[model samples]
Target: MKLVLSQEQRELRAAVRAFLGAASPLPKVREGYDPEVYARLSGELGLSGLIVAEEYGGAGAGFAELAVVLEETGAALLPGPFLATTFAAIALAEVPDKELLTAIAEGRIAATLAQPSIDLIADEVAGESATVTGTLAQVLSGMEADVLVSPALTGDGVIMVAVELAGEGVTRTALETLDLTRGQARVELAGARARVLGPRTEGGVGDRLAVALAAEQLGVMRAALDAIVAYAKVRVTFGRYIGSYQGVKHKLADMHCKLEQAESIVRYAAWAADESPGELPEAAALAQAYVGRACFEVARDHLLLHGGIGYTWEHDAHLFYKRAKTDEVLLGPPRVHRARLAESLGL
Candidate 1:
């Protein structure tokens, strides 16, 4: 498979990076979710529609392109419903609802998946209706989503359902998290009205989500490595650059190696999503298993290398560290993914 990015993809990455550099600076990101910024990302950059089909008002890009955009978002620590909306779109695209796809592509609505529980059954059920109960903890962008794509266990099987958050019996409470740029919330669904999408598969949506998250982690790792390296080069200690020291040089070298490895794994996962659906499950699992912990380590090293300044809230080092920690467990811990990878490998 091709590992290099196409010219168009490179250009798209540059444009997205430039936009986020200006609009999503650390201060703006810390301010929390801004609907206006979301609108601009959707309307001006057409990011909301990145992966949707052209007929549905999207750019009709593949997972690779989507990965590029997500990487930039992660680096900028953009706060909003972007991840939720994108994940919803990825799941919904499998359904036959053209209207919902169109709405999402046009940025008319925001959506996210309610974290499925162990029971997997709807808390309450009636004729053609399901009530989702239980609190979904750490739902990314859960508070601001207009729609929640959730799964409910029914008599037939586990079926994906679309629940309107504006409807009754649904309560969304914002939760404080380590990474402010990525908002989290607790969603309480009490007999929430819902529409069935289709039967849920074991690894369908989860694989896609993992690949997307890996892409984000790749961005975080790269940004952290770059920041630390830049600081090492300029910061002087004892009449010599800190980077000139063997210990510091080795740390930076290790961070670069990890970043490169993570990038390759993430790119392969994204490519597998589009080019080889059958390979996506293992690819995604492998990406998360390695990249998740690697990114977190890189971020941690970044903070440590920065010495005193990195610990402060004012500096950007902590933001990346927080994001890396949160993302490391967002889907599941690295061990979880490693277990899946081992199973996939028939071990």
Candidate 2:
């Protein structure tokens, strides 16, 4: 299969990058979320529903389009619940709720998934409803979400549910997190009623999530590498440009190699997510395993390349570093993805 992006896809990427460059610049991202900017992104740009169906009031695009948008967002470090909400929309697409998807497409309701923390207390089976109780200690964008796509353990199997965050028996509290651009929250549910979505699968959700995140990590690595390379070209030390130094050139070369490898894996994984379900598990694992570490390394080097300025609060280098570090652990780290890949390969 062709892994390269089409001309249209390239144009889409350019458009998204330009829009984000002007609207959600690094300074704007540092200032935090802006509702007005997000509205334009969701409504005018039609990003929130890139992967949603046209019948559901979305753009009826594929994962490839969504991946392009994700890369631009990652580069800009756009604030708000775009990633969380888009992820929820992706998860919900498998279940296909018309009204909910429409709401999401319109950017009226924000949503997030309760993962690695939610639990099942009881399954009433009262006409597509279940009673759930759990505390999600680190839900990304949980405080801003209106609904949660939660998976809970059940006696028969694992069931996915859609829980209303504003309903009774639900409480949300913000949490201190490493990434300032992305917020997390603790959600406590006490016998909250939830609408059943479907049975939970083993690798489907995880693989998709991995591919999506890998795309973002690719963006981060590219941004860091580009920034450092540009800085190296001009910054002078001892009356000589840093880019002329062999050591700096070698490091930049290494970072470029990693970025290329990451780009290939991420693009392949996204294509698999869209067209090759059978290959998604392996592709996703590989993408996450390599890209996560590579992204972090590039971001770390980005900071190091900036010298003392990178460590200061004012420089944007720290932002990329923090974002990379947080993303490295957001889905249980590179080791987890590597382990998953090994198991999948029967290692």
Candidate 3:
């Protein structure tokens, strides 16, 4: 029931924040994906395997720890395939793929989950593998991923499978998006072979993803609020600091309240993912329902508060705005989560 982070978790946050500050400053993040940076993040910082089992060469942590790391990553706007890889790891954990988990923990491969947008078909299955054919319209980190875990429609039923991206029947094409830091791709599989993972069920992977993303949106809100507040303190208009304006003050107060509420919900959602699975669905829905729109509103205000400079490509305000807007719709918009929340509440 304690929503506050422990001392150790605070230290973890500090460490991650410091590392990102030094390694992934805004300029570096603007440079786009870097393989070496991701390598150090995985190998040196040991974040790639932070939540995998110790026996699988990971830190053997839980979703709480992962949430802490993600909050920092979001604040830093760290680039590359870290989020996608984590999603794949979570999916594999549900099915317990020893070799795949080990590879992810060791940073030997990058992976992603095929979203529902990608409707794959598996018409035939022989023994442990299936011939998969379909096109994933937009895959997060698809360009950099080495493997993909997805649900495919089969004659028997919907089943989960893992496909190697580097295989013969697979092709990938990069796509432009609002969030340049997080790249997307188009994947086409012409009867590519895939290893069966397990039978598809009503697992909480989607809910877990919502919670994790809500954590990131919380970080975005924090960073945006802090940045605008700092700017208000220094920037002057009509011979007075912007912070002295009553309108700005009210907006900032509202943003702070939203951020605090979002943090509370995100923390509870992450906790439920780790300690109370029964509460995860409701908690995740609540987190996304509130946090997504809150983040977008905060980011939008953060940009507007900065005036015209915020619209320029040179300023970092647009970056936060773009990330917030993109993330709002990443797993469906805030309205979708709100509906989910309503359904969970039996309303």
What would the per-residue lDDT of candidate 1 be over residues 1-347, giving only the tens digit for each residue? 87789999999999999988887787787788889888889989899989999999899999999999999888887888898888888887766467778888888899887664533357455555677665576678888899888777777677778888889988889898888787888878777777767777665788999999899889899888889989998999899999999999999999999988888898899999999999998999999999999999999999999999889989989889999999899888999999999999999
TM-score of 1: 0.95
On lDDT, the candidate that comes out on top is 3
Cα error, residue 141 of model 3, in Å, equals 1.0
How high is each candidate's TM-score? Answer: 0.95, 0.96, 0.98
Ranking by TM-score, best first?
A: 3, 2, 1
As for TM-score, the candidate ahead, 2 or 3, is 3
Model 3 has an lDDT value of 0.90
| Candidate 3, 5-57: lDDT as tens digits | 99989999999999899989998899998888788888887999998999899
Tens digits of per-residue lDDT for model 2, 1-347: 77789999999999999889888899889888787888888887888878879999999997788888888899888777888888888788778778789988988888887664445554675657889887787888887788989788777777788889999999999999889898899889898999887776564877888888888888988999999999999999999999999999999999999998888888889899989999999999999899999999999998998898889999999899989988888888899999999999999
Q: What is the C-alpha lDDT of each candidate?
A: 0.86, 0.86, 0.90
- For model 2, state the Cα shift of residue 131 in Å: 2.9
lDDT of 2 at 338: 95
Which segments of model 2 are wrong by more than 4 Å?
116-118
